[model samples]
Target: MRTKVAIIGAGPSGLLLGQLLHTFGVDNIILERQTPDYVLGRIRAGLLEEGTVSLLDQVGAGARLHQEGLVHHGVELAFGGARHRIDMHAATGKTVTIYGQTEVTLDLMNARKAAGLTSVYSASDVKPHDFDTDHPRVTYVKDGVSHEIACDFIAGCDGFHGVSRASVPASAITSYERVYPFGWLGILSETPPVSPELIYNNHERGFALCTMRSSHRSRYYVQCPLDDHVDQWSDDRFWDELKRRLDQKAADELVTGPSIEKSIAPLRSFVAEPMRFGRMFLAGDASHIVPPTGAKGLNLAASDVHYLSQALREYYDEKSSAGLDGYSARALARVWKAVRFSWWMTSMLHKFPDEGEFAARIQIAELDYLVSSKAASTSLSENYVGLPF
Candidate 1:
């Protein structure tokens, strides 16, 4: 089989890119190593930057998103037994949409199916070859049979562990990573959220976040040791710890319920430089990863798709290579800013293992200044809402 572009992985990035290209009359194919259900089963961050929401609108996938998504004009930061709110909308004139990543994937998948686009799922050993040459090809085994796709370009949307980035020689890619000592122990509950807007809290014990997918469904998280397991945390224990971290008023009003889903996620900041390798380019988790503190993972991916899709469109529409040639620099410029913001937020909220009392005091000082100073809050709000694409 042959197409203009071959997209690896069927996650949001791949599907979004495929949908955008198809909408513009660019022929493309998507390949996935897992079944559709497995892909949608993975839970992820839900906060949507303005850029991501707009991109969804452009691709005709915003009907469900705009209808169901909850818009928040501000987020609260709780520290020192007091609650302070960051005016994200007043500071930046932009708000974030509270929509689950799962819903986004479902919408994209449904849109793809309705548009009659092709995607190969449950394919094994999917690999990209000859990306550096004028002609690129992708090969995979499906149902015990081998197949190949010859295309003009390949999109490495397969994610961090996928074959896309691994296909590039190590010498050609420079990587930077930082693995934190703790992870986020999170749960999804069926009860109403403790707060209308999301809350980022710093307590003497650890960091906790109060966020929700909708008015009735809530998602919450607390910092935990890296070795902590789900079995060790019962529903009551999780709720108790969450309340302890929140302010007294919220804690008093907090509603507890059985957890529908529970898991722990490690925090890390990773970036692989030069996202482009000849005809193949990396987007989303394939190239960079940020701790969920600032909720940049999927947003960064959307920004990447923003650049990659535009570049690919220009390549086909105008027969120009300038956009494609500049994809790496443009994407990385924005990626690094998010990296800094996520890192900063993580530092301010999380308790580092090696951080002595002095470091903790300084963290408190920083948070105090951040909430007290208008300029500082504005900076935080702008970064939180998202930098321009």
Candidate 2:
């Protein structure tokens, strides 16, 4: 088989990139190791930056998002037995939408199907070959039969652990990472959210976040030891721990229900440099990962796709390699800023076991200054709402 671009992954990054490229009149095919049902079953971040929403709109996948996604203009910081609001819309004239990543993927999947785009699911041993040469190709085994695809380019949106980045020699790439000492124990419940906007809480006990997938489905999380397991946490214990970390008012208004989903996610900041390797380019998790404290993971992926899609479009439309040559440097600039923001947020909100009381006081002081100062709040707002793509 042959295509202009072979996208290795059916996650949002690859799917969005494929859609964008198709709209640009560039043909592409997607290969995934997992089935479509498995892809939709993975739970992920629900916050959408304005830039991410715009990308979906560009691909004609924003109709359902606009109909169902909740729009928030501000977020609250809880500390010192109180809650303070950061007016993101007031500060930056931008708002974030509460749309689940799964929904975004489903929307993109539906759009792609409607357009008759090619996507190979449940194809095992999928690999990109000869991406370093002028003629690149991808190979996979489907139904125990081997197949190969000759393509002009390859997109490695498979993620940090996928074959795309793994295909690059160790000497050709550099990685930076910081694995945090804690993890978030989160749960989803069929109940109204405690607040209209998301609340990020910093407590002496640990950090907690109250976010939602929709008006009626609340998603909440509390910091825990890195080694903690989901089996150790029951619905009652989770809710009690969450209440202890929240302000009195939020605790009073909090509605608890049987958790439909529960999991513990370790926090980490990871980045692999030089996103481009010859004819193959990496986008999204394949290139970078951020702690979820700032809600930047999926948005970062979208930004990578934004830069990548543009670069690919320019390559085909204007017959220029300038954009392709600059894709890595351009994407990395934004990737690092988000990494910094996510690290900052994790530092400010999470309790480090070794840091002790001084660090706690410092965090309180930082949060106080952040909410009290207009400049600091604006800086947070701008980063949270997302920087321009």
For candidate 2, what's the RMSD? 0.5
Provide the TM-score for each candidate, comma-separated: 0.99, 0.99
Instruction: Indicate the residue-level lDDT of 161 in model 1.
Output: 95
lDDT (tens digit, per residue) of candidate 1 on 221-329:
9999999999999999999999989999999988889998999999999999999999999999999999999999999999999999999999889999999999999
Model 1: which residue pairs collide?
none
Candidate 1 deviation (Cα RMSD): 0.7
Candidate 1, residue 214: the lDDT equals: 92
Tally clashing residue pairs in candidate 1: 0
Residue pairs whose backbone atoms clash in candidate 2: none
lDDT of 2 by residue, 24-93 (tens): 9999999999999999999999999999999999999999999999999999999999999999999999
Local distance difference test, each candidate:
0.95, 0.96
